[model samples]
Target: MARCGSKACWFGLGMALGAVVGGACAMLVRTATQERVLRQRDAPMVPSDATADQALTVDATDVVEYRGFVIHVFCHALGMGRFKALCDIWESGAVVLEGGGPPTTHVTAEESRSAAIAWARQWVQRNG
Candidate 1:
């Protein structure tokens, strides 16, 4: 009976250790991937000299032509159920408006898009 008990204890201990090790490895990998992504995002973007039409073709999927300005909406993951929306408005191949929402817990991608479009429209009306 004692021998059986000892064997079960050893097995439980081994399983616990394995779980700990697996969790630590997963955390390390996630951290490394996040760092790499951050580095890539922070890299300097070369400004283009293209016309408005050319710029429209650059990012067709996320670009919106509003009042002769190109508005690009970028969604950034902030982890822990938070997200950020960045609105980059371009005119004549240069950034004319840069704005975004603060990290929020419940904002959806669609909401972010709407907010960006509203902001851009206001900016264009005021400055354009």
Candidate 2:
């Protein structure tokens, strides 16, 4: 029969204990994270009255409407060429306009401005 040394036995025991400790630590971390998420979900929903009037934040964006006068909201850089080309080729008199800057939209200033003025007049007549 072979006899095991104290050092070898202690090393094997230490390795086994380390693996168990590591697994327990991993489980503990996962449970803590789940508990935190659950706590957040249980929190109360804030009432609308508690906040300021969100309606005051108006979206002053440009839009082009069609025969039905439906709003076609877009940005300012969608040039006359693409829209007009599309309409001319397709035989559709659809409106195409947008707000300021390159990123906002792609409507050309010349075409968009003309349309914008027309839009303003129409808006005033209808609203007034």
Candidate 3:
């Protein structure tokens, strides 16, 4: 019988290697895409007037003081005229609470600020 070291054997080996390499590349791409999405989600929605470090400035006109908490409303663009509202509540220069409202097409800066205030009030009323 002839030896099996023919072109067909090499072709099959090449195909198997190609499949393994392709699968590895696909898995790497999937992992990278998932990590990118997670980073975007965890990123803060910084407003245009925020400081360099994205810190809430007390002098900012958008900053609102409710009860003992200072609420900062940040609007982030979500493409297609949509927006995400983030409410960062601070006490003694430290963020004590963080919350957000439903993403909506309508501008919800004021609504987010109000919600933060209400949350702070309720928290105080319950804790005190």
Candidate No. with top TM-score = 1
The true-versus-predicted C-alpha distance at residue 41 of model 1, in Å, is: 20
Model 3: CA > 4 A from native: 1-61, 77-81, 98-105, 108-128
Candidate 1: 10-residue stretch with minimal lDDT: 52-61
Model 2 lDDT at residue 99 = 34
Best by lDDT: 1
- The C-alpha TM-scores of every prediction are 0.45, 0.30, 0.42
Q: How far is each candidate from the true structure, as Cα RMSD in Å?
A: 12.8, 15.5, 7.0
Please, what are the lDDT tens digits per residue for candidate 3 over residues 11-117?
88889999999999999999999998988743555555445423222333256676677776665444323344556667889987665433443344345445544
Q: Give the backbone clash total of model 1.
A: 0
Q: Which ten residues in a row are the worst by lDDT in model 3?
A: 52-61
lDDT of 1 by residue, 32-76 (tens): 999989886334333343342233233422668888988887754
Clashes of each: 0, 11, 0
- Candidates in descending TM-score order: 1, 3, 2
Which residue runs does candidate 1 get wrong by more than 4 Å? 1-61, 99-106
TM-score (C-alpha, index-matched) for candidate 1: 0.45
Candidate 1 whole-model C-alpha lDDT, 0 to 1 = 0.63
